[model samples]
Target chain A: MVNLAVKIKDLELKNPVMTASGTSGFGEELADFYDVDKLGAILLKGTTLRNRDGNPYPRMAETASGMLNAVGLQNKGIDYFIENIYPRIKDYNTPLIVNVNGSTIEEYIEVTQRVNELDKIPAIELNISCPNVKEGGMLFGTSCASAETVTREVRKAYSKTLIVKLSPNVTDIAEIARAVESEGADSVSLVNTFLGMAIDAEKRIPLLSTITGGLSGPAIKPIALRMVWQVSRAVKIPVIGMGGIMNATDAIEFFLAGATAIQVGTAIFRDPFTPLQIIDGLEDYLNRHQIDDICKLVGALKY
Target chain B: MPSNRIRMKKNVGEFTIVSNSALNNTNYHICLQSDIGLPDIAPGQFTNVDIPNNKDIFLRRPFSFFDVDYEKKTVSLLVKILGRGSKSLTELKVGSKLNLVYPLGRGFTIPDKNDKVLAVGGGSGVAPILQLAKTAGSSPGQMHIAIGARSAEDHISIADYLQFAQFYFTTEDGSLGEKGFVTDHPIFHDLTQYNRIYACGPLPMMKAIAARAKEAEIFCEVSLENLMACGFGVCLCCIEPTVKGNLCVCTDGPVFNIKDLKW
Candidate 1:
């Protein structure tokens, strides 16, 4: 039998497949389609310290092979999440990981400290890489020093598996990964959406309300894979790769590129069943390749 | 008012195209048969339909449920050719397969048995307004529907609606009914007559109707058509600012009471 189980620090994942934060929305939406308990982990949507109105209407624009979004972490703050959302999702059989975000270091630390009290939530994916927000998000992730500093501060507040999600809108993602690793991050997830813009030629107006938003989908897989490969080699912690993973083959490519586990993001917008399909496909791939454990495929890319 | 049962679960499965008939140059009536049994779908609720075989269109397009048949396990949609996604959907064959995340969002609150109602619609928004009229189970003289379009040809046929409610129409070019917008019609001027007002159309038209309804102290609800990514609450792309703060148009509503809106 192919053992699909994997681990990140002390947190155990039943499979390498997981739903990316901001895409899954606390794993409630996908529960309508299939049992989310079958997946490795569920990353809740980006939660902030305070309720954010986010941007105005026209937040999404469809592009070639992908789409752009300027949602800007529009959550009801950590209090509402802890009171309303957390209680509902906390009991899901899979490990529930909160994708925590903030506009300031104090906000991030405070949000992290609050989540630390939730016993059901085994980990928190620190999001310093959101491109759509006007402040703090991508600003902290793009630089090595700030990435290290935020990771360092959040680390002190929370005592759990800390996965620092890195932004691709950087010159050296590998260096940023190492910086977070030095600050005591348990693991790192790579290639949060790349910054991009869309326009309407005839109307002479930008498509998205923000003018520019984060680009994600199949259009970004190759670049994300390369970053995952580079970061996985640079850090001792596990690398959760994600960007444009539509199906299992795309996920297998990430495993070959060095991702210990992978997250399905924008693809979930197209097909809600994609993460489950990927889990099944991974097992099929293992059976075909005569591999016993799925972990063997991680970083198996040959020169 | 018909108390809509809040259906917590949603489905994602393939539906085969039963038929695709053009109502006009810009609009098409497409019916889809579900592989799984049809769930109870309410008016103002929508579906995120996948536009397959089109590499250029990546995201699923959201459309309000125009008609649903439980016996046949089918749902029909009123698709207006707005962009590449809707245009691609109109070109699909009868046997084509479409995946959908369906019966999403809270629907309009059906009027009370004795309450008089008025529903206004235009463009892509006409779908749900028509559905609300047909299914409200109102007696004669209780339900009135007004539809507006830029020109005569832009308006789809509502011959099937005569049995359910009284119909009113207005065109910009004055080709079909009264001239100018639906608000220009006499039905909109007398807002006190309607116990509840429901609108689904362009923002300007709904806002105008909402203003009149508010002045007359009538309860009013309007369905919004926002650019959506995921048809569920997760994306938070389709948001409408209300008294409760920024609520997802996909979840908190594609349908909202005018009073709750900041507008």
Candidate 2:
């Protein structure tokens, strides 16, 4: 039998498929459709230090083979999640990871400290790559120094597995990945949505409220794969890859490119069962290839 | 007091198009039959339909259940051709398969047997308003429906609902029942007779009705068509600012009581 299990720091995942942050809201929406615990992990919506109302109307724009969103991390803050949301989701068998975001370094540290107290949550995906927000999101991720600084500060406050989610808007994503690794990040997830924009030619108006939003879906798969390969080679920590992973074939490509695990993002908006379908597909693929362990596929890409 | 409504479990089902026909110049009525049996759906709850074989339109379009037949396991949507995505939906061949997430969001509150309701609709908003009226199960005198469009050609014939409701029409060009908006109709002059008011349409139109309903101190709700990505709570793209901060239009409601709204 092929083993689908993988590890990042002390956290052990049953499988390598996870729902991308900001796509599955606390795992409640997809739970109604199927059992969410079957997947490797559930990355809850991006939670901030304070409640954010997010961008104005028209926060999304659909493009060819993909979509753009400027949701701006609209969560009810860390306190509400602890008191209201955490209690309900704490009992899930799957590892529930929080995608933590902040506009300031102290906010990031404070949020991390609070989440460290939650026994059920095994990890937090540090989000410094959100393109929709004006202040600290992409600003910290685009530069190597700031990425290293924020990782260092948050690392001191939290006591569990920390996966830093990187932005693709940079010229050298591998350099940024190395910078986060130097600061004590247990793992790194690559290629958060690319910074892109869409326009309505006839109306002479930008489609998204923020003018430019983070783009995700099939259109981003190739670039995300390239980044995952580059970052995986650059860092010693396990790399969790995600960008437009719609099916098992798409996910297999990431594993071959050096991703220990992958997350399903925009595809969930299209089909809620995508992650489950992928998990089944992975098993079938391994059996067909005569591979005993799924980890054998990671970084197995030939020149 | 705020309404205590329990959130219902949503379903993702594959349905086949049973019929696709035009209701007006701009609107088309497409009926889809579910491969599985129908779930417990309410009046204002909507469905997110995946437009097949179209690369340009990547996201699924959301529409309220225009009509649903449990016996036939079919749900209908009244689609207005706003863009390439919607226009493509109207042209789908019969028997084509479409995947959908159904019974999403909170629907309108079904009125008590003694309550009389006035249902107002404009543009694509006509779909949910019709569903609300059909589900009300009230006599002709107990239910009133007001529909407004730009011109006579924009209005769809609701002769089918004549047995269930006292219908009223208002077109901007004065080609239909009355000249101005639905609020200008004769029914607006006597809203005290209605114990409940429900609207689903353009922002200005619903706000006008909500204002009138507030003056009469009647319980009123309106369904909002905010721009959304995932037709579930996760996306947070379709949020409407209410008394309780920001609430997702896809989950907390596509339908919400007027008192909860800042407007």
- Provide DockQ values for all models, in the order shown: 0.59, 0.55
**For model 1, what is the alpha-carbon lDDT of residue B157?**
82
Return the TM-scores of chain A for each candidate in numbered order: 0.99, 0.99
Error at A93, model 1, angstroms = 0.7
lDDT of each: 0.90, 0.91
Candidate 1 lDDT over B129-220, as tens digits, reads: 88887888765598888999999999988888887788898999999899999999988767878889999999999999999998999999
Error of 2 at B219 (Å): 1.5
Model 1: residue A22 alpha-carbon error in angstroms: 0.6
What TM-score number comes out for model 1? 0.97
At residue A121, what lDDT does model 2 achieve?
92
Off by over 4 Å in 1: B1-8
lDDT of 2 by residue, A44-150 (tens): 99999998889887889888799899888898899999999999988888999999999999999999999999999999999999998988998999999999999
Quality of candidate 1's docking, in CAPRI categories?
A: medium
Task: At residue A37, give the lDDT of candidate 2.
Answer: 86
